[model samples]
Target: MFIDRLDAGTKLAQALKDHPLVQKIALADRLVLSIPRGGVVIGKKISIQLNSRHDVILVKKLGAPFQSELAIGAIAETGQPFIDQSLVNQIRVDDSYLREEINRVRAKIAMYKTKFRQDKELNLAAHLTILVDDGMATGETMKAAIAWLQGQEKTHSKTYHLSPTTYLIVVPVAASNAATDIRALGVELVCLEESSDLTAIGQFYERFDQVTDEEVIKLLAKN
Candidate 1:
């Protein structure tokens, strides 16, 4: 288990370096997108190790109507939702509920975008983009983030030249099922620990603390 975010970040950096793609691409052509605010901690360490660019992607979970913390899906900055159809059917979610949640999370994503990326936009064209997070639960949030990136990839590839290398996702820990789901995106996924019976992300860490927006702002400033 990791002692904290820094420790996790350090170990994750080493794992990323050991990947086969590390020798295939130039460091200048790589970019690391962190799912803040905890992921930024890991991203910072990775950027330093690989000498790659680092930025934030604002994606959030689309929580269930009754239980605000239970994620039925997730939404990205693009205002699109990635829903779990099986879960939706089992819970009998209506179209209206999905619409409301999509807009709600989109608004939150906008707020975070304005607060975090006030100066510039993330440029994924012609670069090997790596999405980093502290860990995953249902993997809804990360899935939405990847879907959003894939949307950009499809749109921008028609106009600009994209790299031939595959995209990547790295995390300190993740659920085994979620890891498989993430790999289904056709990206190289690197998780330090893929637990079969995962409960909480914090369960694998010795000191998992709250990462605030202010802290994320400061951390990004350093990079």
Candidate 2:
């Protein structure tokens, strides 16, 4: 009932505000990161209200060949990314196909970096990182993001001389199963609504228009 009954982003924000886990962590004092296209609007609002650093954590999904809407895997902000191994195995995607998709996603990330390099100077060392997306269905993108964060911690530990920071994943709405799966990753999760009513993320949103890359770039510039 919480799903499809209110403004997706606002409701999600409020839910996070009320959650005991969120209260314990005090997200208002942390660095809030979000993936573009979906996370930009939500992240901006949260940043303004909470007085936290809102930055984009670029993640692009690798769509199925010919059926581009079907996500097979996802790439995170860092160069490291992941795919649903079971899905990849079930689909019988060859190494060439996987490489091609990976390269495509990397190219997209490169373009994003080129456009927003100036905005990447925020100090993530010892700062709490909150990752946001609009919603979740398969949890592939969230998994990729978590994996990427681990890699970043490993690679930057020496240079930054900081221990791995805590991460929290927030979303407006998510499949009950998907939320559970994400929580099992041993990270804090803040999901506002969990329902079987979810078919697609857009279905619950009253204003589910596409967020362009240009808009994301502009948002980053402002922050």
- Tell me, by lDDT, which candidate is best: 1
Cα RMSD (angstroms) for every candidate in the order listed: 1.9, 3.2
lDDT of 1 at 207: 95
lDDT of 1 by residue, 1-223 (tens): 9999999989988888878776577888788889988999989898888888889988888887697766799888767778988888888889999998888888888888877888367766545777899999778888888777777777887853443246788899999999998888677788889999988899999999999999988888887
Candidate 2 lDDT, 75-159, residue by residue in tens: 8776676787788888888889889999989898878777755535435553567788888887788878777777777877764
lDDT of each: 0.83, 0.72
TM-score of each: 0.91, 0.84
- Which 10 consecutive positions of candidate 2 have the poorest summed lDDT? 1-10
The pairs that clash in candidate 1 are none
TM-score of 2: 0.84
